[model samples]
Target chain A: MSLISVGEIQAAAQRIRPYVLCTPLIPAPWGDRDRPLFLKPEGLQSVGAFKVRGAFNAIGRLDAATRARGVVAYSSGNHAQAVACAAARFGIVAHIVMPRETPQVKIEATRAHGAEVVLCEPGRREAVAAEVVERTGGVLIPPFDHPDVIAGQGTIGLEIAEDLPEVASVIVPVSGGGLASGIGTAIRALAPAATVFGAEPELAADTAASLAAGHRVDWSIEDRNRTIADGLRSQPSALTFAHLRQVLDGVITVSENEIRDAVREIALRANLVAEPSGAVALAAYRRGATPPGPTVVIVSGGNVELGMLAQILTG
Target chain B: MSLISVGEIQAAAQRIRPYVLCTPLIPAPWGDRDRPLFLKPEGLQSVGAFKVRGAFNAIGRLDAATRARGVVAYSSGNHAQAVACAAARFGIVAHIVMPRETPQVKIEATRAHGAEVVLCEPGRREAVAAEVVERTGGVLIPPFDHPDVIAGQGTIGLEIAEDLPEVASVIVPVSGGGLASGIGTAIRALAPAATVFGAEPELAADTAASLAAGHRVDWSIEDRNRTIADGLRSQPSALTFAHLRQVLDGVITVSENEIRDAVREIALRANLVAEPSGAVALAAYRRGATPPGPTVVIVSGGNVELGMLAQILTG
Candidate 1:
């Protein structure tokens, strides 16, 4: 199997430079004395997630003919919006396959970026996306498994290393593992002294289990859906699992309560909004799951429903 | 009678560049289709407010002999923290006179920055600050009204002009008017076409009343304190009043309900925490108080207490 390399990630950085935002690495006020925590708020991205980086890189690298043929993606959250936004930027047709049970806000946000939305049964998203590609002759932009997508996400690691070379540890939330896989690879290549760890909710800790077992572990969708972190419900793909095994130092799992508290802490202390999934790394850090040093916690996204955020803040 | 000119603001920008953050002008996703709104989040500063600009500028400009003498300031909120943080950076002593009723968090934050805090009665902060200056022989860094402070605040306007040259209007929250005076001077000098407007809480509309009467108008402290925006209780001084009359096009006063709604909107929509006082500019813009244009709303600070932020978000 092919793997994403640092050189490709550097190229991805250059390719998506004009499209994505260079989000600030803010110092969190609540950091411990010895280990200052820096927040990489990817939530500040235009599409409110780091998925935009992978989406833009994957779409931008397509040849002229392939680009004109259009793109299709399967996602129920940030990836859908990222793909839609990136496709809109490239002036290419995009067909997004989202679960019918997806939140109205996510669906609306994806549609707002000028993509045709095709709703499917929760587990049928891939099949639907495949059908769309078969029917429309569109290129499939896999959310995380694709090498180009992983390379794209790795750009964030490049930025972290460039901005804070002394970063001793990086805590990234893992879902399908695109972010962790890419970021881990980049940090390994660019800042070898920095250890990369994956954060996951206990309710959906398939990535942790998979990493520990040294193989991809399948968790029922119903089991994964028990977590409030909707974006992290999916298990890692084979490609992402392979990358994670190589690059990640360990996987840290946080309780749902910890996740909610982290979201609140980020909002209250850092003055930045963090969706539940986006806040997992912070949750892990707050729980003292990571090693001491200048730690970087990736606040992955902020496209949460307002009511949920209000509830978390109030609670 | 000397006024803070744009030249002074430019110089202040250079002086404080090494100290203060060059806050990003983020595009508000909730902006109107016709007139987009941008947020200059000074709350993201190290001190969690734009007060750092003035503090750093005023203190940094001191001669080595004077700097060695230390600095003194009177504030119960962001300014105290700003002064403390700036003084700490310069490795000079900071004497901050705060109201006895100041929150423990603010007091602790100020102390954490190595400032010596002296608590006094609510209305006696100035008197206590004067006593501290006399005792310590430290230079007083007045919260507002001083030329250096105004020049420091104007750096925000210079940044705005540089970032968005086509910016048509700037809406700034008016407290003692240092921020508005500085920003207005910079915008008028740099981006001549951009109109400057001050946002005030209707409950503490001293600046609005003063501007309307074409002179300084005093409001009782009790009357100004009625607003939820605690930082906006002080009336503008003669220096700030003169600058407001010359530089501000108009003042927009927002109701308490509007201010609350604005705080919520900024948190939910923009993913940025904004104190009630800091959110008044966005509140005014949302209420259509300003003329239609590409508006820049200064989110003055994010130094709000967590409990209060929770209440606002939930309510």
Candidate 2:
């Protein structure tokens, strides 16, 4: 297992500076008096997620020979769009394997980025992606497990440290754990005094259970799929689990109602559009799961369908 | 009538730098094929509106003795919150005169910022504000007519020119013409090659009609109030009209449906929440009013009521 270093994250920042946006750290209006909260709205990224940072960094690190061979990725959401967009920028061919049940908006967004969309049956995304890589001789870019991807995501933590050196705590939404692992690692190196907390939905709380048990834990796909945070269904890989254990102080699990309320809070108070997965960190913070201080909540993504957002907002 | 100059705008930017946010310009995902659109989301500002820029600059320009006397302002929406927030930052007393029928949310937000909210009859807000200023001996910071206010708002254009020197056109929402006048003046001075256009709802197209007739046109309050964009009901002041005539190339009037569509589009495509008034520029741009080039649209504010936003999003 290769552990990522702060130097690698710093290098990744420099490499992907031109490709990714340095998303603004917006002050949350309803922050507690004792702990002023700021939102790192990665939803404002070009691909509408932090996945762009990792995608660009991983693709940019490829040698000339590998770059010519192109890339293959599997994602039902933001990662697909990120890989497709980053590949387009490099003028490399990309094959994105997505589940056939994925939202039309996500599928269309991926295709719009000039990637060949290969729809596979549910739970066959990984197999389809492997096949594409084998047949096309393309480099496979896993969403959250690789060193380059983790380093790319760490760039966000680097930015937070640079922008707010006095940051006391950082709350990040955890899925396969690339975002939390990268951010936590960067914060550990750059702002060691600041604690890092991972936020997971109660319905898909494998990370919390795993962290508590001191090992990798697996939840059935049906069980993980119960949360409205569709992007956070994947279990953490061994590499990401190792990074999380080293960097995170603890994990916070939020209910479905908490996530819904957080989405509304972000839209109303922060004037930001956040998908359910993107708002989990804020949900955890609102629940007082983290210690008080100058806190930063990472709004992970904003690829929500219109109908779903409307229903949540109205409901 | 003193018109705002680029130098004054530059000075205002410095004065309010500590109080106001230098908002980021986000690239719009659904921009035209020929003209790429960027959104300057002032909604992300501390007060969730560009009004904070003018309010801060106006109050900051006051002498120490005058600042000690505190400030008074009249507004039914964003401006009230702006004055209150800026006053709190400056540690000065704020007396906000709002309409009796003002939304409870706006009223609460103003009070929450530590301002004394004085409610008055809808059309008598100015009279109530004048009385408050007379009684408390507070300096009056009118929303848009004052030179200091216009100069402060002009800072947006300065930032736009600095960030996107290749910008060819600017689309600004025209409510009382303050935003348009200020932005137009700055763009005219800083980026002379760029053309400035004002966007207004067809129901309240007083600015468009005024510009076409070469004078400030009057629209009855009832007629103007028929539009969903409540912030745009006010007609342009004589001072603002003079500036608009000198700076604006044209005005675009959009339908009510178009404004609603723009609100949804900003939320769905750009992943940013925008009020109906703030979304007029994009609505006009969508209607093909601006020429093909790199265009910047000022998303003036994002203080939309949650229920209204839900209706717009769902509808």
DockQ numbers for every candidate?
0.47, 0.75
Q: Which lDDT value does model 1 have at B295? A: 91
Best by DockQ: 2
lDDT of 2 by residue, B1-315 (tens): 778788999999999987788898888656888999899999999878899999999999999899999999999889999999999989999999999877787898899999999999979999999999989999999999899999999999999999999899999999888888889999999899999999999999998998888887789988998899888989889999999999999999999999999999988887888989989988998988688899999999898888888899888
Q: What are the interface RMSDs of all the models?
A: 2.1, 1.2
Q: What's the TM-score of each model vs. the native?
A: 0.93, 0.98
- Of the true interface contacts, each candidate retains a share of 0.32, 0.70
> Which pairs of residues collide in candidate 1?
B154-B182
Model 1 C-alpha lDDT per residue in residues A19-48, reported as the tens digit of each score: 887777887656987779898988877778
- Across B1-315, the per-residue lDDT of candidate 1 in tens digits comes to 677889999999999987787887787655886678888988878778899999999998999999999999999789999999999989999999999877776888899898999999989999998999999999999999799999999999999999899999999999899999999999999999889999999999999999898788889988988999888888888899889998999999999989999998887667778889989999999877666778999999887777787778777
Q: Rate the local accuracy (lDDT) of all candidates.
A: 0.89, 0.92
> Candidate 2's residue-wise lDDT over A43-154, tens digit each?
9998889999999999999998899899999998899999999999899999999998888889999999899999999899999999999999999999998999999999
Our tally of clashes for model 2 stands at 0
What lDDT, from 0 to 1, does candidate 1 have? 0.89
